[model samples]
Target: MATFAELPDSVLLEVFSYLPVRDRIRISRVCHRWKRLVDDRWLWRHVDLTVYTMRPKVMWHLLRRYMATRLYSLRMGGYLFSGSKAPQLSSALMRALGQKCPNLQRLCLHVADLTTVPIASLPRTLKTLELHSCEISMLWLRKEQDCSVLPLLECIVLDRVPAFQDEHLQGLTRFRALRSLVLGGTYRVTETGLDAGLQELSYLQRLEVLGCTLSADSTLLAVSRHLRDVRKLRLTVRGLSAPGLAVLEGMPALESLCLLGPLVTPEMPSPEEILASCLAMPKLRVLELQGLGWEGQEPEKLLSRGLPHCMVIVRACPKESMDWWM
Candidate 1:
């Protein structure tokens, strides 16, 4: 019986890739064969920054030589930049990655701080980018690059980042092929940013804005209306009102909708209000609500209106509505 260690490199890598990057790296530490194959350029093809403990310079040197052609995707967590030497580390890593990973297709950076990114250093082949709570200026996306065509580009997830300006959003218009966009953060992102991005993205199909404090009832209402073609929408904030619920009523094509927030305020609307507002969405196939309840109110009315075809998830949601919202 061959132990995992005895498996051929080809067989081992196929199995290794299925494990999380962390697990694969852990396995690599056990013995020479595993480590050798794990460090193989093909195995390191899509590096997840979460798994590596090497110094930034070491990672740069490794990529420049061993993993250059193999790398196409990079997913990094916020902790990668939490080190005291992050400024020096990140700058070197970015420069090295930009130079070495020319065929890179997807880049996910979840760094929570930074006012600007070295946009000029990014590879032109990048097609998918996800930034979670990163300090990325829209100006960098707008003014820094010379490439006009990103044909394979599709998804951009900017979750809870605070680096957006109207002019910065206008720059996203350059990506004619962009489709899915997820923007959620504590930033004071205006409806204008959404409007600007959506209007220019002729092929956009999914849009999400979580924790945005859109100006007023009218502007908030105008949000769902503006992203008329968006088939999936997620809007989460502290307090949602009647008018905010009303805006969702008009999203005819929305198949997946998530309305989430902490149920910790006097201003928080009842679950019934959200359900009633969204009851008319004929095509809604998925509904997710987090922290769904009022202080002392029953959600029976909201439960009764639940759509049977929809895959409902009410997490931290009241148990009473499980049968209906399930």
Candidate 2:
């Protein structure tokens, strides 16, 4: 059997990479040769410090040792921001990265706000950014001067953010290379802003809105006509209407759709219109409907009659009192 000492340094580095960052640092103390091996630049390429919530001092120590090695990706998670000293301690950590990790390309911030983002330290090579519940605002997001700092920004994921605006998109319009965008937890986003904001994503190919309150039919129709290039779409419409169904019909290239929330009833368009639209969708493969209650008679039998060939997954709600059909 090959002893630990006999293994090649490449093999050792690969093995160390699998271990948690804290564990890798601990192993570095085993011996001088191993310490040097652990310090290898390749070992720190993708830094994910999510597991070190209990011992953040160790994260600080590792960052101090490797702040300058052309870091490509960084994901900082856990209770680091949930603690009492998060604002101060997190700021210090970000400051350290800004001063050292000059080549950072992708960043994921799972914190409360952006007050201490160390934005000035962000690398010029940055392209992808994901913010989870960050305290950023439309005013802050619309600052064109601040946006010039990330000229290469391409993809953005704003998950559970409270404030965003159509004007925020104006700052990103210069990014001709921008492609994918996701807006999750959009209860705060007004229908008008939601519509205007989507119109500005000129090069968008994929879009996802988790909790938006928009005119589903009209907004979707506009997207299908103007943003015909969109191949992937995910939305949750509370009151599905005929106009909204018409909009869905325009998405000729749609392949994957997740329609959450319930379909609106006894409203603008009739049930026949909605059913016809569902039947006409050709490229659709996966369909997820949550909290759906059909008020019409024999819904299961009616669906079995028309929507049998769509390869759909229907999850009707008990509230609708609609019996299941296998």
In candidate 2, what are the lDDT values of residues 163-190, reduced to their tens digit? 6655664555655567777777655666
Alpha-carbon runs more than 4 Å astray in model 1: 5-36, 39-42, 51-54, 77-99, 112-118, 136-138, 143-151, 192-197, 215-220, 263-269, 294-305, 317-326
Model 1 gets an lDDT of 0.64
TM-score of each: 0.74, 0.69
Q: For residue 158, give model 2's deviation from the true position in Å.
A: 0.9
Candidate 1 residue 201 Cα shift, in angstroms, is 4.1
Decoy 2 TM-score against native? 0.69
For all candidates in order, the CA lDDT equals 0.64, 0.64
Backbone clashes in model 1, listed as residue pairs: 160-184, 160-185
